[model samples]
Target: MDKESNRDEGQAGPVLTRRGFLGVAAAATAATAGFAAGARAATPGKDAKGDGGVLEVAIIGAGLAGLTAARDLQRSGCDSFIVLEARNRVGGRTLNHDLGKGYFTEAGGQWIGPGQTAIADLARELGVGTFPNLWQGKMSMVSGGACARIESKGGFDTDPRLTHELEEMAKLVPSGAPWKSPRAAEFDAMSLGEWLAKKNIPPEEQIGWATGIALSGGTAPARLSLLHWLSMINSADNIYERLEAVKEGAQETRISGGSQILSIKMAQALGDKVRLNWPVLRIENWQDGPVAIHTPNGVIRARNVIVALSPPLCNQITFDPPLPPRRREMQRRWPSFAPARKTAHVYKKAFWRDKGLNGWIFQPKGPVLWAYDNSPEDASFGVINAFVNVSALPSDPKAAEVELSRIYAQALGDEALHPVAYYDHDWGKADRWTLTCISPMPPGFLTTYGEALHPPAGRLIWSGTETADIWAGYMDGAVRSGHKAALNALHAMNERRA
Candidate 1:
C-alpha cells in the first residue's frame, strides 16, 4: 500500500505563488483533519434502507457526480439514500497513481480553472487545496527528429486570429444545448478539421489546434463536431484561450491530494450508505414509483434512481420496460471512443527546469501529444505527465516507457532517460465501466441525440459530467450534475408526500 500525506512544504520554482502556498497549507490542515474524522466514523456496511424497506434515492456509479449527489442528500437531512458503484473503488473517472511517501500524481481529470466554480467550491468544502499547473518556461515542440524551443506562457502557441474567430463562433452556441444555437445546423454540418481547412491554416500552426482539441475532446479535429467544440469554448466563457491554454484556462489549476480525494472524502462521510462493487445489472419498474434495482449482490428498491453513469455506460444496464426511443437511441449512439492513455515519468528531481524548460513537450509526429511538468507543489520529486497517442506507443508498459523516455531525452536533456519510476494508465484497458475518458462529440451527434441527454426517463434521472449544462465533460460539470440530480430526487420525493 502506498503511504499518503497531505503536507505541502519546500516550494521550488515559480510554479507556486505566495497565495498558493497559503492555500496549500490550509488545505493540507483541513484534509488531514477530514481524513482523521472519516477514519473515526462507522465502517461501511452492506446496504441501507428506509422504514418502508425502500430507499428514497439510489445513485448509480460512484464517480464525482454520484458521490456529490450522495453528499448533497446527506447534507439535506436525508438518509434514505444509497450510492452503488460498479467498481470496488469510489472514484469513477478521477484516479491517483500513488508514488508512495505521501506523494501522488493524478491519472485522471485533475484540472479546474476560472469559471469552474462548481468544482472549486466543492474542493473548498471538502478541505482540498489547489495550485497552478507549471507553465513558466519555454515549451518544446518536436517534429520528425528535430526539437524547437518556443516561448509559450500559456503552454500553447496557436494563431491568435484563428482563436478569435473560434471564440466568436462559440458565443452563438449555448454550453448546455449546442443544438439550440442559431447557427447549429451550419456549424454541426461541418467538423473542426473542415472548418480549419477552409481557413487554409498552416500545417505547422494546425498542430497546436489539433493537439488542443484532441486533448480536450479525445479525438482528431477531423472527427470532432464544430458545434460541440464551440459549445466547449462557450463553457469557458466564449474564450478560446480559456478553453485551451493553461494560463487563465480550463487546465489552469490542479486539486490538492489529487482529484479523486474529493470523491473519497465524500464516500467516507457517507460511510455504509456507499456500496462498492454493486453493479446495477437491471432497473425494473422504473416507469413508476418504487423502482427495483437488480445488482450482483441483491435487489434494492428506490423511489428515485439517479443514473449517474455516462450515456454509453447506461447501455450496459437493461431497462426492464425499455427506455424512451429517443433516449435509448441517444445512449446507443453516444460516442465512447476516447479512452485516452496518460503516462507519468518520475525522476529524482525536475532537472528540466534548470535548462530553462517548463517540461512542456508537444510532438506533432511522435506518440507524445502533450507532456508537461506535473510535479507536486513542493517539488519533492519530478513527475512529467503526458497524454500519449496509444496506437503509436508500444503495448508493453516497460517498452512504452523506454520509447517515451527517449522522446523526452530528445526534448529535455539526457537526464530524462534516468527516471526512477514510470506509471502508465490506459483508461480504455483500465476497466469495463469507463468506456471513454472524454466524450468527443462527432459532427451531427448533438443535433440528432442531444435533447434526450438531460430529460428524465421515468424514475431514472440522467446525471453525469456529460449531462452538465455549463462544463459538460469536466470535473466541474460532474459536480454540477450531481447537485441537479440530488435536487431533482428531493423534489420528486417531496411531491410524492404532498
Candidate 2:
C-alpha cells in the first residue's frame, strides 16, 4: 500500500502478482531505511570479524547497468551489496556539459526513441522527461566547397530498395546473437561496404549510408561486419530506417536534463551504497563464492560480483585463475577503438530555424560527420552538437572550436561564427576508463566470439550495454542488461542458500 506499490499496481506493461508486488515494496522500504541509517558507517573495505564481513553482492562500475542492478537488489530486500565506480562521478558514458542557467548539453550517450522501452521505463521511474529531437525544415549538406540544402521529413533520403534488402537480411539475424543466424557465416564473411558495392549504390546515396553507419557502428562500412549491422537493424524491428533515422527511430528523443541525470538520480537514491573513485583493480577467487575485489583503498569480499563494464574494459581488471579462454579472448579482441569526439557550440539563439533550417549539417568529405540542433527545449539559447573526425580537427580546444565555427558558418551563415561558448570532449583522451563509445564489430567478430558474450564466468556475471540482447551499445540495452544481471545474481544467491 506504499507509493511504489501504488505505482506498480497502476503500471501498464508487465504486471506482477499482488503478493509479489507487496513483498518487493515492503522489502524496498525496509532496505531504504536500513541503508539510510548505516550508509555513513558502512565501510566496504573493512572486514567485520565473522560471516558479516562478506557482502552478498559487489557491483563493478557505477554506470547505468551497475546502478540499475543495485537498485533492483535493494528493492528485492537484498541490502548486503555495494556499487564501485572507477570515475569520481556516476552516469558512465552518459555525461552532461553544463550550459549555465539550468541548461545542459550531453557529451556522451544522449538519445532514446521508439522500441527503447527499458531506458524509457527507467526514465519514467526516475521522473526524467523527454523531448523530441529537432529535425524540422531543411538539412544542409556541405562537400568540396559547395553546400546544398534539402528538405527533410525526419528520415534520410536513402534508397528504399536498398533499405528493404537490409531489412530482409536483418530478419534472419537475431538481435540477441547474430552468430546464431542461419546465414551468419555468409554475412559475417564480408563487410557492409563490400555488400553495398555489389548493389551498385549511387555515389550520393552512399554518403548517407556511410555517415549513418559510421555514427552508429563507430566505423566506416568497409570495416563493419554485415551481420553485425543486420543485428542492429533487427534490434530496431528489422527496420533499417528505425536504426538510422531521427524521426521514428533510435535518435528520436532526448532525455530531459541530459541522459546523465538518469544515473545521477539513481545514484542519489542509492545513497552511500554507490562508491565513487573506487576502481576494481583485481578480482580474486571469482570462479567461486566469497570473491575478493581489490581496489586502490583496500579489498571488499563478496559472495557475487557483477561486472557491469564494457567487454573491453574488462581487460583492465586482473582476474585470478584467469577467465575462460573464450571469454578472455573476446575481452582481449573486443572492439575498443571507437572513442568518438563530440562538441557543443552555444549560440545566442536558434538563428538557423529563422531561415527554415533544421540546424543539421552533414559534410561527406569534411571533418564533421553530422551536426544537429541540440538547443534546450525552452529555446533559452541554441546549441549545435556535432560528431567530428578527431584526426581532421585541431588538437587544441581553442583551435578546434574556431575550425568547427568556420564550418558551421559556411553552412548556417555568418552568425554561426560568433558562438557564445564552446565545449569539446574526446572520449579517448578524456579518461582512461572510457576506451570506446560504441562497439563497431568487424567482419568476423560475432561468429568467432559471440558465444562467450552472455555466459557468466563463475561468480562474475557480465552486464553492460554490449551484453544486451537487443539495442546493444545503447542506453536502453544498458538498462535491460542491468535488470538481467540483478535477476541472475538473485537466482544465484537463492541457489547458494538452498
Worst 10 residues of 1 by lDDT: 10-19
| Model 1 per-residue lDDT tens digits across residues 1-498 | 221212111110001000011113444435433322222222223358776788899999888999999999999999998888877676677776656555667777888888999989998998778888888889998877899998777846688898899989998999999999999999999999999989988877788888888888789999999999999999989888888878988889988777767887887778778777678899999999699998878888899999999999999999989999999999999998888888888888989998889999999887998899988888877889888888999867889888999999999989998788887777787778888878989999999998999989889999999999998999899999999999999999899999
TM-score of each: 0.92, 0.91
Error of 1 at 153 (Å): 2.1
> What lDDT score belongs to each candidate, Candidate 1 first?
0.81, 0.81
TM-score of candidate 1 on Cα atoms, chains taken together:
0.92
Off by over 4 Å in 1: 1-47
What is the Cα-based lDDT of residue 239 in candidate 1?
81
Instruction: For residues 1-498, write the lDDT of model 2, one tens digit per residue.
Output: 011101111111100000000011233323322222222323564432126788889999888899999999989998788998877667778776655445677778888878999999998898678888888899999877789999987866778999999999899999999999999999999999999999998887888888888888899999999999999999999988888889888889888777767786788788778887788899999987689998886788889999999999999999998999999999999998888888878889989999999999999877788998989887767889898898998878788888889999999999998888887777777778888889999999999999999999889999999999999889889999999999999999999889
Predictions: Cα RMSD each = 5.5, 9.1
